[model samples]
Target: MKLKFDGFILALLFFIVLAYFFPQLHRWENGEVLAWITSIGVSLIFFFYGLKLSFKQIKEGLSNWRLHVFVQLATFLLFPLLVLPFYPLISSEIQHDFWLSFFFLAALPSTVSSSVVMVSIARGNVPAAIFNASISGLIGVVITPLWMQLFVDFGQIEVLGDVYWGLVKEILIPVILGLLIQPLLGKWAARYGKPLSLFDRSIILLIVYGSFAESFDSGVFETVGVKYMVMVLVVVIILFVVIYALIYLLSKSVFKFNRADTITALFCGSKKSLTHGSVFGKFLFVNSSSAGLYFLPLMLFHAFQILVVTIIAQRYNKSFEEAEK
Candidate 1:
């Protein structure tokens, strides 16, 4: 197995184990310090990485209107459109908060780092992936809130009104600053990108642990039983399959992109960004128990997307090797 997958699985297992055994450690009051540290620290790291991106790259990416449109459609439009109709079918016994959270996950944008990595792995359009991924993050700041307003009642959450500004200041501004500094740090960024990405990924794992630890501490897990867990797992699987299949068909028929580009679209387009999901969840839900529940689908989707797309990417890699032979 790839080291990325291994690292993710290990991090997940560690969090689950921590939540199970160290109940006190997971408590919000007890863990608040760690949580804040992880949140602020990760946000800063995210900003620095963003600073390394160039405005010229963003402009060039925008110029690839076809790829941008297709990725956006698959992420913001198609996924949510598929998910909304099913909300009625889900049993009312399930927490409204959890349902809303799931919907939020569906509405978020494609991931930045992983999507680009997957695109590169599958030998797809790297520049296009960078463009689409960054643009998707920017668009999500606007689109996610609008979707929430239309579908969910935000009155319960105090942070809803200022969430976008928080994202802009915490996430977007940092990213923009990073891009601006790209001219000076471009070489340094290129040299250290891998290490920086690893650092970013580690911070994300901590965020996941902190979020879940908070949920466990708040008795959220006790409220959700085996049935709820099973339902969530099923929903996650269905979401992945439907999105993957839809993107595959669209890539073939409409986009007429090459095989590698199609794979990139399928992976990047079908998956949501965990980094954005975690940060936004923190901003939107704040100390609410539902924030953890809301981020559940995103966590599940991240693992599932990587596993599924890794297999697909490997297969694509093999096929390319065979074609050359």
Candidate 2:
């Protein structure tokens, strides 16, 4: 079987390059326009997210409580705990920011589309994957912030208040509105899932462009040497490998899950969402001048997870075919 490159990953890299070359465009009227665009885009993305989520499917998925428990624990608890041990290594403000990036990646929710797609490809429990993936974002809205709050000094209580308020206004409210109307428009949203997804990606791309553009303009990359970048890449790979292996062992040996459940656990439990990472960064690091640095590990992890999971999914596919033969 041949390996296929994901188009969105390529597009992600392209926007970073574009931002490096044309950081000026993002500064139109001191970035007010781009900020407005991203702010609105974040709300709409979550709105459509709620609009498409099938509560019936979620209800069906709840029967597998063990699978749901494992996936959610791996996402919210295990990932952050693994990274928390490294916090003592921070010696300076820069190192603190870098460490925070890794923690942020660990704290994020799993990707809904990619997780479900990979599980389906690997012949896993697709409904369970869908349920876990869909619910992870809502869980993250509360959990991710609480995790960050433990470490992040959001200036004052007022600033922290503003962050939660922004989250509610931008993410929660829109999602609630969408859910309220989901009965009326859920089918319509599901019908145009592809286009809505495209719209979602477009908003993310715009956020990426604007973010990197600001960082580039502020000379953030000048401080980050190639050695540091290479280190980040290596650490990202290690993080993925460790989490993947741990989940695999737990699902198979401890939980005694079947092949389908094992695959769902591995894929959903190990994945992280760049979508939530992008939107959450806008709020979490709202005061930071070099906010793009925070997203760097997330973007890297996003690409790496997609590439690695696709290969694993294809191998599982091949194995299933051979067993049937």
Candidate 3:
């Protein structure tokens, strides 16, 4: 019923159906053109995100440094650390690239849009949520590539020379530019944040469609059977539950953040940024065919996270209501 569920499902279904009928749509004769479009689009989105961020909100969030630190640590450090040991558990066929992509998904930053949306839905601190989510995106640009370099070799990826700089140029620089101009746009962004958010969501939907369209067009599914798909889904579900449980326990025992802050941290810390994942995929993995495969886990994770977090946010809202009564 909610837009979160209905919109995502409809978008995904439309992508798949479109891919089935219009597989040729994915073929781009010029690689540079596609790269430029994706880069420019992502840069603009990050710029707008920075424009919406309020320095006053970030200062307030910084006052609760402990919660922010814990959430960031869990997102950037703990999640990847947990996935590292499981590399031995995956089969060799998916090892070199496929599994590496999955780990890359894990290592990505938290979702800036959805994290704040979920927190707001659950009646958590919106300003704090925005601060944490934005900061996480900035932090991830460095942390993600560094993590990859440490665990996986990029020898197979021909675009290795440009990958790091591409991330900085395409992702980080635009975001910085946005933040710099926040004062100019902050008032307008505040007034029309909802519409701008809708625009952001639409861009994400387009990226999703583009990624899946390429995958289906390239016959990636033929190489990976239903069994592998099932395995990945199971892993996604398990990883989601494990991270959710870990955050819950930590929030209750060690962190001792209030209910709202805990909810904010749990939602923000446990989710991955699909937007960042797709943009990074285009930038870092230039091999179009391989990039499509790499994006599969990210797409799956995005859908899974929204579904699970929607339910959790609803339940959290109910719990808060009961507590107030």
Candidate 4:
């Protein structure tokens, strides 16, 4: 099986390097323009997300209660549990921020497009993948912040109030507006899914650039250093492997899920959303100049998940094709 290179991953890397060299652009006029641009882009991204969701699809996929429950639990609960143990062990503010980054990764939703696409490639339960992946984002809008609230403080402004309010304005309202108008535009949105997805990626790239630019401007990386980044990558890989294995064993052995459901659960359960990471990081770490530091682990995890899962999905597809032949 041939492994395909993801241009998106390369684009993410490119943006980070660009941010390093041209960090000034994001901070032009104290970053007001860049911040305004990303904020609008973030809302539109979720608006398009809402537009693409199908109630019929969600209803159809809900029948498989076991698979749905397993995926959600693994996403919101199991992933966070793995990282929670390390919270108390943090020795300094810097160490705490690094831990928060991984925890943020754990708390994110499963990415919708890639999870569904990978599952489809592997001959998994595609409808269920779509349902789980779609609903995961909506759930994360509420759950992710609550998870973060357990550890994060928003400084002077009331923590829960400001966080939830920002979420309402940035994510929930746009999504609801999209859902409300879906009857008129849902078909249009579906017809143009590719462009919408491209738009999503473009906004994500902008956010990454703005974030890293902030980090570079503040010299946050100087304190965090390359050693910690290497550590973050190692931890991200270990986290993915462990979550993937647990989902595999539980779905196949404990639950006796069929091949398709097992594949869907494995892929969807092990994934995290970089899109949400970028948007939510803007709000979650708003008080910290080191916000980009928090996004670093998530970006690493995002790239790693895509590369590893695509390889596994291709192997699954090849095996299925051989069996058919």
lDDT of each: 0.76, 0.90, 0.76, 0.89
Q: Which stretches of candidate 4 lie over 4 Å from their true place?
A: none
Best by lDDT: 2
lDDT of 2 at 91: 99
- lDDT tens readout by residue for model 4, 1-325: 6778888989999999999998887878888888888889888988988887766787898899889999999999999999999888999988998898899999999989999999999999999999999889889989998899889887775656877787788888998888888888999999999899899999999988988888888888888667998899999999999999998999988989999999999999999999988888888887477888898888888889999999999999999999999
* Local lDDT at 163 for model 2: 74
TM-score of each: 0.89, 0.95, 0.89, 0.96
Model 4 residue 2 lDDT score: 79
lDDT of 3 by residue, 160-180 (tens): 457778777777787778777
Tens-place lDDT per residue, model 1, 74-145, is 999998888788677666644576678778888899988778877887788888888888888888988887
Error of 1 at 275 (Å): 1.1
The better-scoring model by lDDT among 1 and 4 is: 4
RMSD of 1: 2.6
What digit string (tens of lDDT, one per residue) describes model 2 on residues 42-140?
Answer: 999999988977668879999999999999999999999999999999898889878999999999999999999999999999999999998898888
What is the lDDT ranking, best to worst?
2, 4, 3, 1
